[model samples]
Target: MTFNFLSPVSDEVLAHNELLTPQALGKKLKIHSKAHGLPDLDNVKIAIIGVLENRNDINYMGSEVELDSIRKVFYNLFPGNWYTNVADLGDILKGDAVGDTYFALRTTITILLEKKIIPVILGGSQDLTYPNYRAYDSICPMVNVVSVDSNFDLGDSTLPIKNNSYLGKIILEQPYNLFNYSTIGYQTYFNSQEEIDLMEKLYFEAYRLGEVSKSISLVEPVMRDAHIVSVDLKAIKASEVSKEQKYSPNGLDGKEICAIARYAGISNKVSSFGVYEYQHSKDDHITAMLVAQIIWYFIEGVNCRVSENVLSDSVNYQKYNVLIDDDELIFYKSKKTGRWWIEIPFLPDVNNKLKKHTLLPCMHEDYLEATQGKIPERWYKAYKKNSF
Candidate 1:
């Protein structure tokens, strides 16, 4: 029924694969076309949905959408060694009003999540993330969002929402299903001090671009805890992508952004993902191919997901405790995957309390820091958040 909101992919785009590259993805993907309808949803793990709404983008000025351009490159990438059923569900034509488009996105994503399919959105603007977040309200009790971008996108909620400021809408909107929000690869120059303060005030996490480029593995913990990951392509360095995506001279390199994408895919919790801010322009191939590779890495990471690391079963994990000052920090290492988590102790006399000793994902480096009589930053942040 929800499929009613979707329009099938164009015949022209489907016909572009006629060049006969045997290994190209057009030869492999279960595409929605004039001849074949939507692929069966039963075992489908991923669905690609394109959107054309940009009226709320702030930068919108009758510009064409780049989703088809992205598809042109995506359809040509060779499939990797993987085992996930994927479907191209086609595009959601922009509604007369932007709100209508949001409604369509919300309803479509909610339906797919109900069927346990991950919707990989190719959006007209990053503002669409608001609807992606809303879709989780009925499917899950809470959600954790991870955004990989150079800017915070937390604009004034008093102002109309734009691609640059949609986080304001997501954080302030009703029903309040957001459990956590984190940003990776944020550059200081692009954000304001007020927004940085806002992040600290809310106990949200933000990793700077320089730190992330130095050590990419730090994102895994955040992704391990995310439900939705929205990537703004402007976060990538200009040299790696087409000029249209070049928002910053200094940003993440192509490989780093793709690695972040893969981490999002490897997360057991992440259900909905999106890449936005793509523009239709000359030399779109560079940006399109890069975006395609990022998607490929995400699928690869999904196939490479590890299990047998359930923390609730004590038999599968080893625990260690380190005391920093008067507080004792407990850490767990999974026997199967070697992943680490630190326990956030429940506070006393707190209403709406979390269960005792709730685990928060951490890296082995955090454990080492704790052993050195220092509290891991993640544990300290979680402890402060819990104390409130």
Candidate 2:
């Protein structure tokens, strides 16, 4: 029934798809259209869905959100050397109410997850992430969320949900499935001192914009543990986007944002990805192209994914143990991918969310830091959170 809510791709975009070259991504995708109905999703590795509801935006006017511009640019781009099948499931038009739209998105995402299809969502507002998170209620017992935003978005949970404050509701609401939440590229000025304190108090990770800009690789491990990765387009700097999408003078640039997308795609745990806070403008080619490139890089990363069971397989990884302040920190490095992970010691007494997954993704630098008689902040935080 929720599939019925998804409208076919616009005739205008379909007409444009006909003009694309044989090697273009549009020519390879199983696109849903008025003439073809829904495409067979069998063997499809990724499914693209557009959500056209922006009523929950804090600065919402009467204008509606559109994705045809991005879709057109995306379709015009050539595909990478990939073996995975992809599908465009078309758009989910806004329902009579915002809740109705959320319900439709939640159901559709649930179905895609059941079919082992990763959904690359084009969203109207960042608040749509709330529904995407809810779709995991029946799929996984615990979830980790990595939000790419300038603010913590922990708006007053007591107030009505808005794009700026959706995370507050997610943290306080039912199901209690969210185990850990991390923010990348956050600007301190946009968040309150209380919110910053709460992030620390709750042991949630927050990486500043400057820190991430200097080294984009820092996000890989954070993304590696995330199940849902939600990106706010407003997190991008004004110069990198169109006039309507210009939200901040200082944020992630085009290159940095695309790199983050690729990192999210490379993560084996990240199943759903969403880029939100889209504003429609007369000429949004620049923003559309950037978004399309982000999607392209993500697919490229997915294609390059390497499966490594570092815990179960010892032959593929090198192990190191460091003694720091009476604590023994164990580290594992994959010989195949050169990726590192630190072990979180299991405590028999405390209730733990990470009972099965003890290896926390880390960097070689973290192992070096532990060798210097210092504890890695990430391992410490994870250790503390697990003990809670």
Candidate 3:
């Protein structure tokens, strides 16, 4: 079992946990430690797993990746008024080979998915997202991925898998389960024009940093439709993280990133969440606290999730129809949550990947735009992807 590959939380962290206030999350969580083998996962809503593999990082030198700092901070902080049970499964130590580590992570995440427990992954490098995405292969037929990143990371699929190029592997690899991929807070200058053009050509979604920061709520719908939400810490601005952790001067702030994490947690479709690109440094306290708060807010959002009877009953939602450019567009709004969804027309001629997800999550603005005879870009992209 891949769980056997997992090492217990360090005695140091456990000792620190004992000193934390009773109200702290450390006291509330079912922790995996030397004393306790594995926590009973019954009714457990979330599982935290730390990955200690960063050799895949293109800039790798021979340094080790440690997650104890983040764990110490996260456990010391107080949780919100949450009823959902959380478990810290400790860390997945690096294996004999990078592929071995990926296998361990992939199997672990797959088991967690089968049990209907969300795996909140604290990862060393962003490439671990490939395994996270792979874990969904057996659980779901089609998957939507949302990345909170500054670059597309669609490097050469022809090359070996690395943090910057893992997306290409996900795209070209067998089974072709990726239905849609969306990126939030992407910096235009960081991405090559070819990659940007490829994103548009493939009908994938990419939101710029300024646009998302201007209105953080814009990510709600995008996140609502996502199955795997991967966040890269490098997407955060230099001012928000430690000196060694900063990869860009222009990126999302701490608040913006946390808000995005909350949105990801609130999404019913989002089953796996990961924050990657963590670098241990002498002054990592700020970054650790920020990451901890991000996790906390995610838990709070999950607890606050409102179950909206989206398409079951007509009485539960209000339906609207708009004619744009001689084509009829259908939209539905949940009366209970006031959330909107635009229907993706079924293409009988083509094998559709989104048949189960016919009602694509959207915003009120999308309906208003359609009413004005303008096709919302998201709707257009979905429609095009479905047609192909």
lDDT: the better of candidates 2 and 3: 2
Error of 3 at 31 (Å): 0.3
Better of 1 and 3 by TM-score: 3
CA shift of 229, model 3, Å? 0.5
The CA lDDT of each predicted structure is 0.86, 0.93, 0.92
Pitting candidate 1 against candidate 2, the one with the higher TM-score is 2
Model 1 C-alpha lDDT per residue in residues 1-388, reported as the tens digit of each score:
6487888888878889777498787777778886877777888899999988888888788886758778888888888887897889899888988899999999999999988889999888999999999898888876889999899999999899998888998889898777778999999999999999999998889999988999999999999989999999888888988767777789999889888989989988888889988887876788888888888888888888886455558998999988888888888999888899988877767643366667889999999988898788877776776675
lDDT string for model 2 (192-302, tens) is: 999999999989999999999999999999999999999999899999999999989999999999999999999999999999988879878999999999999889888
Of candidates 2 and 1, the better by lDDT: 2
Model 3 agreement with the true structure over 1-388: per-residue lDDT tens digits? 4477788999999999999999999999999989879989999999999999999999999988988999999999988889999999999999999999999999999999999999999988999999999988899988999999998999999999999999999999998999999999999999999999999999999999999999999999999999999999999999999988988888999889899989988988889999999998875799999999999988888897888766778888999999987788999999888899988888777876655548889999989888888998998999899887
For all candidates, the clash counts are: 0, 0, 0
Number of colliding residue pairs in model 3: 0
Worst 10 residues of 2 by lDDT: 348-357
By lDDT, who's the top model here?
2
* Sort by lDDT, top down from the best: 2, 3, 1
Q: For residue 24, what is the lDDT in candidate 2?
A: 95
